[model samples]
Target: MNQTLHAIAPEKGRKNKSTQDDVVYAHIFDAILEQRLAPGTKLNEESLGEIFGVSRTIIRRALSRLGHEQVVVLRPNRGAVVASPTIEEARQIVFARRIVEKAVTELVIDNAEDSQIDKLNQLVLEEQECFSRGDRGAGIRLSGEFHLQMAEMADNPPLLSFQRSLVSQCSLIIAQFESGAKSHCSYDEHFELIDAIKKRDKSKAVRLMMHHLDHVEKKLSLDDDNASDDLKAVFSNVRGKK
Candidate 1:
């Protein structure tokens, strides 16, 4: 792993009960999404506790939560590691995302306020800036957040929660099976979807969202033989150090 992987630290501020666990979980989850932590990389509890300035108990809690979400695997006596999703799981995730996101885009068209639309546009702008700066990891994270933000704007908490999980899983799948060196989400497609929503063109928004997801799915090399390997070399800079 890269040395930067050791840079998982809690934010500087007040601490509350279980906040440490949340911080640790977010760090690991973000690392996975950013491809800094490869699938099947062993998540040593003691090492993580040291890295995040937390206790082993807290690390265990965080790992357990990730396991529950199927983002990591917890093995008997083997501790935890990042989840290596199968090709079937990957397909299912993309399918679920299309269903949920189509609903979300339609709902946003129906219910979004001007301010919410503005906020989404701002996020896309920031995402474009990240891409322009060659910050692929930041761009990828921001791209996923854009979808989550849209789900929030849909004003359906249950669906929003589901989208969050699905998006996170998609991040892992992309990291594992993405083909070539292309970006995951197209900025132009996102812009078009936002425009459709802004115009309250429900049919267009739904159509654009589905097509956008299809484009994303088509970028994965799910059949690659080496796709199952733990790509530690790709993220060799990530060291679970403090």
Candidate 2:
């Protein structure tokens, strides 16, 4: 009786802590995905704790989650920072994405309902609007979301999970290595993908997916260099959202 209550009490406390950690994790992940927190940006634990209004323990847990997902690199003595994938790593990431996203395309075409397709169209519209308004960060995030949502529509939990991490990594990769002013994805290409899915043209959808990935990969050059440790200014928008 007393023993059982004590065990359950500890579990409940852990659950509450985990829930708080998830909120913090999502904010950081979305910030990275949106390119607001640029690659190589230092993520100061104390600053994050103050911004999120949580303890350092909670902030650490959230950063740990991001580290595990490979978007944030955890340093032993230096703490954590946004991961800047090396050029070689960037190549492999795109290669892996091509494989996974092709499968995701096929599955989505087979499983996605018309309503789901419509929802994807709506996402593209929003992405176009964002780009038109010069909100490139928001636009790029929405472009990544379009793919993530397609993975979700594929009806495979494992694939969706893989995409959740891969999309974030790719976004980071683009922010680090992309050349010139090219965008990560074209909204027009996204629309064509939806049309192929709507018509259940698996071959066309897969082809479009591959070509789209190739464009994104080809835009990467080694000329970019970025470094910033202004943690609060980097996360200013994220802090305002809290």
Predicted structure with the largest lDDT when compared to the true one: 2
Deviation of model 1 at 178, angstroms: 1.4
Q: What is the lDDT of residue 169 in candidate 1?
A: 80
How do the predictions measure up, each by TM-score?
0.81, 0.82
Off by over 4 Å in 2: 1-23, 30-38, 182-185, 225-227, 237-242
Q: How much does each candidate deviate from the true structure in C-alpha RMSD?
A: 5.2, 8.1
lDDT of each: 0.74, 0.77
Error of 1 at 59 (Å): 0.6
Candidate 1 local lDDT, residue 187: 76
What's the distance in Å from true for residue 140, model 2? 1.2
Give the lDDT of residue 45 in candidate 2: 86
For 129-167, candidate 2 gives per-residue lDDT tens digits of: 877877765666677778888988998988878887788
